[model samples]
Target: MKFGLSLLFIIGFVAIHLLSRRMKFVRMVPRSRFLSIVGGISVAYVFLHLLPELGEYQEHLYGDIGNAFWSFLEHHIYLISMLGLAFFYGLEKIVKHSKRKNSKKTKSSTGIFWLHIGSFTIYNSIIGYLMIREEFSGAWGMFFFFVAMGVHFITNDKGLWEIHKEDYEKYGRWLLAVSIIAGWGIGAISEVNELIISFLVAFISGGIILNVMKEELPEERESSFTAFFIGLFTYSILLLLL
Candidate 1:
């Protein structure tokens, strides 16, 4: 049953990527407004669902929490969360650094292009892996996860395309699309401990928060408050009802 459901999602995931790349609707929407809505929905998921879910798992993973190893492990999860955010931010910094260092000598930096592709490949793989592992109770839960993540993946694809342009078109998107399937395959076959799964989810929560904010909060982006609030409230309500 799990495999069947996952296969459906994998198909959906691939279709979404293809559509987001080619669809005029995605391009027609104001970039900032669309991103604002997506980002707001992402934030709602993190705060309303993801973090609370992680908290529920904490007791199971940490046990009494008085033991040194338990304490250390708990700390490690939080640290990993922060590290996920920092890692992505550092990747951006590195790309910018490369761009600056090579700007005068060349119009395009090959090093920066590859770096961007490599980083996003890992990011997409992580997202795809997590998709297979996401625990949901029923059709509604699965649907919710699918919608939230489908939109999130579109945002990530656009972000990469904007940054890498020709490189993303030539190499990045296809690799990323394949990585999603690969991740799902790996996740289906793998048996990870619950504690490890908890930590991975926590880390992803942080990365999602950071990535959404990076898109929505930039001054130049000019995000739409109304659109953002609508997405926030709508998803928040669904989560509450669920």
Candidate 2:
């Protein structure tokens, strides 16, 4: 059952990514926004928790929003990505402080944009980390995290594209560099594992984040040590799970 379910999940996504990205599924989503993205993550959280028992394929968190949201996030990130795009579109409507041009043009939203982002990360990260810790099970769950993470990446690609199309136009990519460094640095706030997996998680997380912020911003590379540090840590965790 475990093996079959894993295969089923993989095949299903293959069909969806290839046939459905351009399909009515994408079009039919009603709200198509970020809170909706949060809603998707919530569903994913529940699904993942249920998956292991279904397939006898136990797995834990994939460093997704941490624990609170991790259970299903790897499954739902695509929705989250789409929802994020929708959320931004909606924000364009309700935010009175939004820089609307008197005639047509608008100004770069430097202040509140960061404000929104800051709040989002803090609220999500705490919940997510607890979920990861909560998913403390044996190693069989490795397939659950790795495969889900792979699928999650594709969704991230969607989120990245949508966010770039809509928001980065104003912010300029400088924030990409700053935010990545900040996320990695802060996620590594623990001096305990500062040189270990924790820091790398922070760094790669920073990278995954900046990936969305990319193309619009100048390409920036982390130092070889930092890059390796982050990759090593990520792979290490993957191996641990597997």
Candidate 3:
């Protein structure tokens, strides 16, 4: 029960992020993807872990307190990630400090985004394999977390990282911090079966291709029969092994 809910939370999260630009409220999510990732994890815990335990009669009381707790965790994670990001920011300052006026300015591009995707895919495939063991709910939980993190990282493109570029070197690490914590929290609270979890994960992952089409290769990306077959084939391989 816990696992399925957590997986769905992740699916919803990735779905929202991947498809956000098309939605009417795309610009009005009221929070950044960073907050959503953190909030999704924290919120799911409240719903799955604490909500049911509260019983239906006293629902309002528990939910309110749980929400407060969720907020606390979200803020804490944000602060912690900020500190980690700050470290990277400091490092960026150092790197730029040694630069001379003769140094060429670099531009960020889709290649950086692709790097994130590549890393996320390979990493998730491995983690999924490791976590799919028999009689290991904890392992499965971790898998959900990793899947969420992987999807977030792979799908992430917009952010201060891209906006500020050299101005915020810690952006990548901040993203890493957010993705990692959210994934871990979701996994820790997850309680479901392997097949269901995998399917939901695959559903979320399919959105990555969607993201690529919408953001990365909006025009150049093709989706003909051949491309469809390739995508289907690749997804089958991943679902089978992982």
Give the distance in Å from residue 96's predicted Cα in candidate 2 to where it truly belongs: 11
Error of 1 at 60 (Å): 1.1
Off by over 4 Å in 1: 27-32, 64-71, 102-108
RMSD of each: 2.8, 16.2, 15.1
| Local error of candidate 2 at residue 52 (angstroms) | 11
In terms of lDDT, model 1 sits at 0.75
lDDT by residue (72-112, candidate 2, tens digit) is: 64344334434444554454343334545322334324454
Best candidate according to TM-score: 1
Return whichever of 1 and 2 wins on TM-score.
Answer: 1
For candidate 2, the 10 contiguous residues with the lowest summed lDDT are 214-223
What local lDDT does model 3 show for residue 197?
Answer: 39
Query: Which residue window of length 10 is worst by lDDT in model 1?
Result: 23-32
Residue ranges of candidate 3 with Cα displaced over 4 Å: 1-152, 155-164, 186-210, 220-231, 237-242
Candidate ranking (lDDT, best to worst): 1, 3, 2
What are the per-residue Cα lDDT tens digits for candidate 3 across 1-242?
64454445445444543443344432212323332333233223223322232233133233333455444432233233234334334433433353433245453333443354334433343233323221334545445444434434433434324333543344443444344335535446564543333333333333332333333232332223343334344434433353
